[model samples]
Target: MSLDKRKQAFINLGHFLNQFNSNGIVKKENVLHNDLFFDAFKMQIKRAEEYNSWFTQNNVLFALESWTNALHHQNIYEWLKDYTIAKDSSKTIAIIMAGNIPLVGFHDFLCVAITGNKVLAKLSSNDKYFIPLIAKYLEYIEPSFKGKFMFTEEKLQDFDGVIATGSNNTARYFDYYFGKHPHIIRQSRNAVAVLDGTETHEQLEALSDDIFRYYGLGCRSISKIFVPEDYDFDKLFKAVYKHKDILKYTKYVNNYDYNKAVYLMSLFDMKENGFLMIKEDTSYASPIATLFYESYTDLEILKEKLNNDSDKIQCISTELNIADSVKLGQTQAPKLWNYADNVDTVKFLLEL
Candidate 1:
C-alpha cells in the first residue's frame, strides 16, 4: 500500500474518534465506517473500563482526543518529511507493547506500517482490545493493510527487528533474548517537573493535569517535582485541588490510603491535602496518588544532574527554558514526532 493510503486510513480513524468527548458520545453524520464501527467502538470502550479499573471513560476519551489531534495530514507530513522511508521492504518488525496507558504502543505500530514494514505485535493482556479494533478499522479503510498487521498472544517469531517496552527487570530479559536482532528495548522512565516560585496559578493547575492524568500510570506523567529550597506547598496544593475528584476512583483511593499509612508509620515528613500526597524524596518513580518532590538550591546544578541522568527521565516539564523540556501540562499530549525514551523510532525502522 502507498504511504498516502496508510496515512489516510489513520486520518479516517481519527475522525471516527473525534466524535467522543468528555461530555458524552455524539455520533456525527457521514463518518466513514460509522455504521459498522461506531456502536461497536463504544462497547469496546465500555469493555476497556471493565477490563481495567484504571481505564476510566474520561481517560479513554482523553487518549482518543490526543490521537485525533495527532492524525492530521499536516502533522503526518511534518513527522515523516525528515526521514527517507523505504518504500519496498517486507521486513517484519515485532513489537512487544506495554499496557500502562491506553493505546500506549500505537505509535510504534503506526511507524512500522507507514515505513512499508509488516508489524507483528504481541499485545499486552491489559490492553488487548483497543488497538486490534483500530487495526480492523484500518484494514476496512485500506484493504492492503490486511497483510501488513498481525496481533499475537503467543511468543513473537520471524521478525527482522523488535521494539519492546517494559520495566527495568524485563529489559534485561529483552536484551538476553532479542540481543542479536536490531531492537529498541525500553525500560521504565518517569517524567519530572521543575518549578520556580514565579509560576502562575494557571500553570500550576496545568501541572496538576500532568501529575494526575491517567491516574499517574503513564511514563509521561509527572511523578516528581523540583522546587526551590524554600518553595511553599500552599500554592501548589491550591492549584492541584481542582483535581480532587480523582480520589473518587476506588483503586487510586486505595493506593492513597495505603501509601499514606505506610509513610506515616515510617515517620516521613510529607504533606497531604485530601487526595494527593507530596513527599520529599530522591526517587523519580513515585507510587500511585503520591508525588515525590525535592528542593534544589542551584538551577545550574539541577540542570546538570537532570542532564546527566537523561536515560532515567522520560520528559521534564517546566515553564523555564530548559533544554529538551516539555511545557507544563503538555507532557501527555505528545506530538506525533515525540518519540518515547528520546529514541527515534521511525529512524530505527527506516534503517532496518
Candidate 2:
C-alpha cells in the first residue's frame, strides 16, 4: 500500500477517536466505519477500568483525545515530512510495549506503520484490547494493512528489529534475548521538575497535571522535583489540591495509604494534603502517590548533576535552561515528534 493510503487509514482512525471525548462520546457523521466500530470502541472505553483498575474512563478518554489530536492530517504530514523512507522497505519490526498507561506503545506502532514496515507486536496484557480493535479498524479502512501487522502471545519470531519498553530489570533480559538484532530497549525512567521559587500558581497547577495525570504511571509523569532551599511546599500543595479527587480511585488510595505508612515507619519527613505527598529524596522514580523532592543551592550545579544522570531522567519540567526540559504541564501531552527516551523510532526503522 502507498504511504498515503496508510496515512489516510490512521487519519480515519483519528476521526473515529475524535468522537469519544471527556465531554461525551457523540458519534460523528463523517467518521468512516463508525457503523461497525463506534459502539465497540465506546464500550471498550467504558470497560477499560474493569480490565485494569488503573485504566479509568477519564484516562482512556484522555488517551483517545490526545491521539485524536495527534493523528490529524497536518500533524501527521508535518511529522513525516522530515524523514525519507525506502518506500519499498517492509521489514517486520517487533514491538514489546509497556502497559503503564493506555496505548503507551502506539507511538512505536505509528512509526512502523508510517515507515511502511510491518509490525509484530507483543501486546502488554494490561493494554491488549484497544490496539487490536484499532488494527481491525485500520484493516477495514485500508485493506492493505491487513497482514502488515500481527499480535502474538507466544515468543516473537522472524522480525528484523526490535523496540522494547520496560523497567530496568526487564531491559537486561531484552539485551540477553534480542541483542543480535537492531533494537531500542528502554528502561524505567521518570520525569522531574525544577522549581526556582518564582513559578506562578498557574505553572504549578500545570505541573500537577504532569504529576497526577494517568495516576502517575507513565515514564513522562513527574516523579520528582528540584526546588530551591526556601521553596514553599504550601504553594505546590495548594496548586495540586485541585486533583484531590484522584483519591476516589481505590487503587491509588490504597497505594497512598501503604506508601505513607512505610514512610512514617521509616522516620522519613514528608507532607501530605490527604491525596498527594511530597518527600525529600534524591531518587528520580518515586512510588505512586508520592513525589520525591530535592533542595539545591546552585541551579547550574543541579543542572549539571541531572545532566550527568540523563539516562535515568525522561524529560525535565521547568522554565529553567535545562536540557530536554518541557513546560510544566506539557510532559504528558508530548508532540508526536517528542520521541520517547530521546530515541527516534522512525530513524531506527528507516535504517533497518
lDDT of each: 0.91, 0.91
Instruction: Residues 203-296, candidate 1: write the lDDT tens digits.
Output: 9999999999999999999999999998989999999999988867889999999999999999999999979999999999999989999999
> Against the true structure, candidate 2 has what lDDT?
0.91
> For each candidate, how many residue pairs have backbone atoms clashing (under 3 Å)?
0, 0
Please give, for residues 198-255, the per-residue lDDT of candidate 2 as tens digits. 9999999999999999999999999999999978999999999899889778999999
Clashing pairs in 2: none
Backbone clashes in model 1, listed as residue pairs: none
Question: For every model shown, what is its TM-score relative to the native structure?
Answer: 0.98, 0.98
| Location of the lowest summed lDDT over 10 successive residues in candidate 1 | 80-89
Distance from true position, residue 309, model 2, in Å? 1.2
